[model samples]
Target: MTNPTANDKWFQDRAVEQIHMDQLKRVELFNGRAAMLGIVIGILTEAITGSGIAHQIGLGALVDGYAACRTQFLPFCF
Candidate 1:
């Protein structure tokens, strides 16, 4: 006969692995969404700020900041 305790342990391990996989999927989805939103916001900001050398510089900075924040803080939010 199979040991009930060993069977339960096996099932529990599989469940934990599944949960980790789901969390990873959610994180990837969130990252993609945040990246797209950042691009849109950067373009809009540049447009509203007006065309000039300053606008390009500002847009680059904004996009870089957004990427940094998304990488550093988004995991905690998720």
Candidate 2:
């Protein structure tokens, strides 16, 4: 027969583990969002900086910026 205290401790440990897992998931989600935001911000910064006065303002700047940001950001993923 399992001791009552042992069963309670097991349940408590499981609960704590679940909570930690949930917190980790939240952190992952937050990090993903932050990374996405960083990419977007980087792109916008590049585009704003690149928009020449003569041209009709194009998407090329944004794309280039995204590429640059990706290269810079990928290393952090590891």
User: Which candidate leads the pack in TM-score?
Assistant: 2
Estimate candidate 2's alpha-carbon lDDT, on a 0 to 1 scale: 0.71
The residue-by-residue lDDT of candidate 1 on 16-78, one tens digit each, is 999999999999999999999977877787688765434466543334556646666334333
What TM-score against the true fold does each predicted structure earn? 0.56, 0.61
Worst 10 residues of 1 by lDDT: 53-62
Clash count, predicted structure 2: 0
TM-score of 2: 0.61
Model 1: per-residue Cα lDDT at residue 76: 38
Stretches of candidate 1 off by over 4 Å are 50-78
For residue 13, model 1's alpha carbon misses the true position, in angstroms, by 0.5
Put down candidate 2 lDDT per residue, 1-78, tens digits, no spaces: 889999999999999999999999999999999999977776776688765322234444334556546666334332
Collision count of model 1: 0
